[model samples]
Target: MRISRRQFGTLATASAAGLMVPGLAQAQSATGMHSFAAPAPGKNTHPLLAKRDQNAILARIQGLMKRDGVGALVIVKPENVAYSTGYVSRFAYGPGVPAGSQAAAVIPASGNAQLFINLMESDDAPRMTDDVDVTAMPGFVFVDDGTPESRQERSATIDPLAGFKDALAAAQDMASDGKIGIEKGSLLAGLLAYLNSQVPEDRSLNSEDLLYEARLIKTPWEIDILRMAAQHAERMMSRVAQQLEPGMNALVLENMIRAAGWAEDKEYSMSNMAFQIGIGPYWGVSGSNRNYEIKQGDLMRIDGGGTHFGYISDITRTWAVGGSPTSKHEEIYDALYAGFLKGLELLKPGVKMSEMYAEVRAEVEKSPLLPTYARGHVGHSISLSPLLEDHPLFAPGFDVEFEPGMCVSLETSYMAAEGSYAPGPYNIEDSFVITESGYDRFTTVPDSLVWDGSLTTQ
Candidate 1:
């Protein structure tokens, strides 16, 4: 387990190279498309080989299946497919691909799982993991290399419909009389019809809720990835904050945030959508605008983050534009920060989410500067989904208890009304993983409200 840095680097390089499909580069070049780059290794570890525990994940899935009386799960959603089989397909994630052409994972409660993918990804699918068997369906006709093995592979490709039927049959055989759970929302109409013809409607179940339940608890590997994601977001925000000056609009700042991600070979997941830049009276509106220029004495608010290997980071920081924050700014920020700190203190295991929300709300109300401040929720869970927030929100009436291995975000935000004192949004948010005792914070940026223009671009 104690691998030297040089050995780890070699192993990481080999793992990256192993994920390339045969003739992929040539195919990309012939089609005038850029070749996809392998995900960059984390700063301190090989994320996949060193941290990802495929066995642990599968065990958790099977345990949940048993508890739900689901004998088998047919996963068609791209995220669930990757979670089950470790095969992250580019075509599956892209919008141009037809519904039936994307990859799927069939996992039984007590046996080996199967990954059904298009023929083009056959080479890379097996390299993703040895825990599941790969079944390549008919799609993506490749030029024959004339090798015996290549010829055999091409000859073995069957009709796509037939392939789907065979996979369903295999699942039924493995499960016997047990109920089959399928991600009904992600299946194509034709595929669903075919499945209906094979399995009785009474025996079929929608697996969406079960899948979400499985993902609610973060594995150690997932926590590590989320930690790295938060670190990247903090670094990106710091870089963006340094370049903040008068006359710069929201669009320019948004692009700088994206550029920071690209510079580190990371994908900008939130991009322009979840990125909120508020100035003046537009405090509650989300997204960036080209016309909103930063002015001295304007309280600037930024709330966003990026992804690292599919896991997301959601952090918010607000500060002055070019000079010291006004007294009103200090008053509001101090109130919100107090709520944020109280939330952090209550983030330990066994605390109910609703109790935390109530406590944080009471703490914020204690501040005379904003006694009437209110919010629906202080924060929510964070994970692989691009939608950002996940289940068990820190809101009223949510009675879910905090558990170890759950990744969450805690925030204190106030969007002032137009013409109110220091009319703008004020926010302080960070990501954390609930631990055995308390929680470990992922974001490290200073929560100070003053922006003195002291930061320099890296």
Candidate 2:
């Protein structure tokens, strides 16, 4: 279908709004936030994703199965599917299909897992995903009224759950112990009920905790892919800021970045990005979608995440619109950076995420420029797009210690006090992963704004 530039921007901008960190009413004020655009989808797979280590992923799942006595895990969540199978099928994810397709993975007690796919994705499965035992819904002729001669397409076009039963039947056979696992959080009640009915007993139980526990930590290959995503975000931010002109609307930056990413991919399914102007709560087009023209002396906050191989790279930086930072701005940034830097240092293996949050809050409180709307925490895990963690930030957790492979976003968020001469929200963010010793920073963008109130090169 043909879409006008204006319409496309509106639709895509709505999608990118999902990247915003949930909190506050996201109330809008006079100033605004920048909306980020994502690249179109690409068919050519990246080498990194094409070579994802299947054994490492399977081992983690198998280890959990052995310990929990789970005969199999019916994986449906897109992130979990990708993590387990190392596949990047477009069929696995789509709008409105939040937890992935109606399909599920029938992981047996041993050997390769059975990947049940929807009719629409059956053909794309073999070409796009990793080599695995792929069972797709049977294709049938799709008759359309537009056929002058015969506008009909035949392929896997039958029942959406046709292939699912096969996998479910297999799971029923393997789950003799009557203990199968599924992501309770992601699956709907109807699906869960159906799954239970399919099995001899109500054996399916929530197992997302174990799955995330394993995925929280990154592998060497995954880290590299995340790094590539980070670089893309950094460059996109610079490119957007460079082209900014007075009176240009907030969407200008978003569209520019979108164009740049579109050069790489056309379908923006796997990527996420956002920008915020120093418009207090009313900033960035991310949540607001307002059309605010640019002005000098305004602040521009670039909060974005680049997706490479389906991994996310989250990074944030702020700039003074006129290319000159006022002393007040510098003062606020200094205080924010100090606490955030120390928080990064505290990210060592075995260190609980809660301890680090307390330490950071204490440090930030020490600054005379006390936070006005501070949340008394640092940040959360930067998992696959739209699938982040709930804790390890904000407050102490259930003794979940820092592991060597989990990627997280180190950030400081606070709005200026009413009386104080503060910028909109005093914030900065970057992505990093805990290492065996300390941490490996995936986002290379510097926290400091240079003399021009902009970053030159980091």
Candidate 3:
């Protein structure tokens, strides 16, 4: 458990090498197009895990239900579904998929978990899951738009609210008289309204409060995967920084980051990437903007995240598009870095998340050059998805405690005064995790305003 700095370095190198193996070999083959599903058979192919890690996850859910005193736990969130069962689907509104029926995975309190994936995604479920068996065996329950009979109902024909009802019914059969603990905030407005129709006019259904309190802590297996993901994000950011040029637009910069994540050993690379970028005060800019160019003086902030084996790595780096950093930028960068490190020092088992935020906020407050933009604390725990969707962000009243097994993002940023005539304000951010004794940076970008060759063409 005591991994020395040297051991960490060795482990990092070994991990990087392991990631590169499948990535490099797959690049030469025709089927390399397959995303990070189960690797096709190859020399020493890793076994596709089947129902091995279910006990811990199931136990966690059962305990959560008992401690919370809920008769049935209804899991509707995609991330929660992925956590309970290793299956992930492209349920997002994209391409040919209908905007509605967004593929959903659900686990009931007492019965089999079900996945309502489009026919296209049924096969990918098993390959993606480590445990929590899907009922349809190697395939998921396909919901086609064509008919309610096939479950492939179109977004228009089969109401998602109805599907939810059916899922609840499946769970209801297991515990008919007990209070059902629906994952609060998870049911869509329409679905909630529909479910209300079925409830007796006199009865109130008990829904579970946000379930992420238990999920805030990561397990060793989860941490290991996150470590790999962070490495990929860091290396990708570094490599992309090396590729940035004066004229490259947001789109190009974003692609470079994405490519680095997928450029790993082809076998374990990500299928897609998500990002945001900006030069001025606005921190939420994103996507491919081939036209907007990166100039020499632009304070480039690229916030990117990548996934490996479904686990995610969220990272951010703000630096000069070129190698030069304005003194002001450096000052802000130093403040932000200091805040991040201070938070890292405070991050450990037994510390409340709010306390860590307070530590970072206090550090930022002392910086003469920084703004009061230290709105919240440094970061929060991460898992199979980005930002954990709607979890707390270093705010008060959130009493979640950090534990050794959890992976968290140490994100901290400062709003700077607008340059005399520049676009506006700017900020810097990054991510890291609490470790057994200390912390580990997921995206290993150097905490400096000067862009090292890692992200610049100098």
Which one is best on lDDT?
1
Higher-ranked by lDDT: 1 or 3: 1
By descending TM-score, how would the candidates be arranged?
Answer: 1, 2, 3
Candidate no. 1 TM-score: 0.78
Over 4 Å off in model 1, which ranges? 1-50, 95-101, 140-167, 185-194, 264-274, 284-288, 368-374, 417-420, 451-458
Task: Score every model by TM-score.
Answer: 0.78, 0.78, 0.76
Q: CA lDDT, every prediction?
A: 0.71, 0.62, 0.57
Clashing pairs in 1: none
Error of 2 at 222 (Å): 0.8
Candidate 2 residue-wise lDDT, 25-70, digit = tens: 1211102343444322644454445566766767777777888888
**Distance (Å) between predicted and true CA of 384, model 2?**
1.7
Which residue runs of candidate 3 sit more than 4 Å off their true CA positions? 1-52, 92-112, 126-156, 159-162, 200-210, 247-251, 265-267, 280-284, 288-293, 385-390, 415-431, 440-443, 453-458
lDDT of 3 by residue, 1-458 (tens): 12233433443354445653424422532233644445555312234234236556666776766665555555666666666665655663354442224555455555555655545665566555544454331124455556666664334344445445555665556445655656545565676666577655334344434366556666656666777666666665665566565765454444344444555433354645666666534444545354565677567676656765566767676767677766766776777778877876787767887887887877876877654644755665677654433365666766777666667777775444446323323444455567667666555556776775444211
Q: For model 1, state the Cα shift of residue 27 in Å.
A: 25
lDDT of 1 by residue, 1-458 (tens): 12233433443344345753313312321324434445545222223533567778888899999998988888877777777766666777776554435677888988778988877887777765656899876654673668775555444445546556656777797787789998877677778888898899999999888888788898888898788777666665665566566776554554444444443333222222246667756776556455677777677776766655556778876888776777888888888888888998899999999999999999999987777767999989888666677877999998989999999989888888777666787888889999999999887445577754234222
Native-referenced Cα lDDT, model 3 = 0.57
Backbone clashes (count) for model 1: 0
Model 3: weakest 10-residue lDDT segment is 43-52
